[model samples]
Target: MNDLGRIEDLPADYVEEMRKVNLVPLWPSLRGVLPPLKPKPQTRATMWAYADIKPLLLKAGELTPIEKAERRVLVLANPGHGLDKMQASPAMYLGMQLLLPGEWAPSHRHTPNAVRMIVEGEGAYTTVDGEKCPMSRGDLILTPTGLWHEHGHDGTDAVVWLDVLDLPLVYYMEASYHINGERQPIKPDRGDRAYAGGGMVPTPIFERSHKAYPMLRYPWDEARSALLRLGQDRQDLDCIQITYVNPETGNDAENILGFYALMLRPGQTLRLPARSPSCVFHVIEGGADVKIDEQSFALTEADTCCSPGYTPVTLHNRHADKPTFVFMADESPLHRKLGVYEVRN
Candidate 1:
């Protein structure tokens, strides 16, 4: 009918005209709206075995040149959730980046926040916005959004590190801006001074033009000492957990992510009930059994595991002699800021 009796039964031509004017019919779509409550996360618990990836990384190094392979990285793709098979998750991007000795990964800057956790080798360095900082195994480096950064290895052995970014989230928002920088010599630019004064409070002059942590490098040595001391000093400790804070502002790593280093004592088990923010973890030292929801993952050094938001997980260090060191990055910053971040027993 050209003219229907009621507004809900409008003519097809009239509906088409409304749609042409950027109007959407809400009656048919509004019924599908529902609350967010759901059983376990849609993003499944996934693990990337280091052993399975090492040889392929080595082979890629032999065949591909750093100049050609802007990033000789193997992205960790989550099979359970992603628009494409190459995405780590629907919201984040995770990759294992390798740099062979004498190789230089060109400088680039992007809108998404970037994090690098050294997993293998040392003497390699990453220069962020002109300040070149040395890398060592277990060190956590932050390259905030839109910061020009590059990596190179000067050591004898190849260096590998975990590359974590909010690429998926930024890309989804259509706000991603990545630009490659010209090849240039690495500059010290007071990066060494910050590293030398590792545990001390950073001076006001050291703060760079970034919203994230001023201390770019959080050395493993200093963090290890602090964790061990915390364990020894306090008997009521549930777990030795420490957040990589922006010393100047005394806040989480940044406004979008929370980075943490936690330790589980030998033969100990820590039960993390569940929370609102998803967490991705990197095994820094020793081995542990991570039970996410009902699935179990055995992770060793350099291995990575993801426990999606609101999924209860338990970490167990069955090793009788060594403690388990785990580095984790999560949406805690966002959740906590929104007053939704929480952890049960």
Candidate 2:
């Protein structure tokens, strides 16, 4: 602590210079922006995001048993692409995964909070804290950091989902972990037979205090429908534009991070206002003229556009009206973590 004293600012004189430049006069000067609105910038992140999984997955699927099992895998992120394989964000990484059926990722759990949202498929089970959660389309399942969890699909089908965590957050916090989980002989608990089809509410339980995600699944159907409706109305600047919100609060899920689905309505040139946050868009169904920082790129179904945050972003609907819808996610969380988030206007 003694060695660090010199690093602290000298206060009055350091800020008093603001007057010399006339940036702020007297009354509304240094004191006005006191204490800083957010935390100090921790570090610059090594930006690594890309979208070219189909070809990779296809080639792998042909040889491996994933396809034979009627399952598929598309790695949304991984260290090979700059995303730490085990950690999500620097501060959080419940663990990243893409699983299909007739295969088991093995039983394992560690002290890293994690969760999964079923992107596609049905009848997959994720046992957490000894409580087996059967996953279905739109279902959200949690494997609290170190709680024992295993995945398996005995049904006549396969499943897929998006995984999120404090991985990046964890790595940033410098609390990353690695573990080899034990293989359990059987399913831990099958007590909640009622909540078989996902949606946590329908399931019965004994002790509810030690909790998990309040809901089993955050449905993308309603969200998708809403965007579709907005597209149908030919509203303002939407090929399809809508933001992700936390269901309980009805506010943006996380101030630093947000999501929007854009569906273009044929020949629709959706103009995206320049944003302070970098955005990544995954083409769900259609195409566009994804332009960023003045360079143009074509984005088709299953393609992706990852723009550097605060970098100018613009889009033009090239397809003649069939409608182009995409799912957008961003590092507003990262920006907030850095404490420099704001809008010029």
Best candidate, TM-score: 1
lDDT for predicted candidate 2 compared with the true structure: 0.53
**On residues 84-177, what C-alpha lDDT tens digit does candidate 2 reach at each position?**
3543233332212346456666666655455565545676777665566777654445555556777777765545555555556555567757
lDDT of 1: 0.81
> Model 1: how far is 8 from its true place, Å?
17
Q: Which ten residues in a row have the lowest lDDT in candidate 2?
A: 41-50
Candidate 1 off by > 4 Å: 1-33, 36-40, 83-85, 184-199, 202-212, 342-345
- Cα lDDT, all candidates: 0.81, 0.53
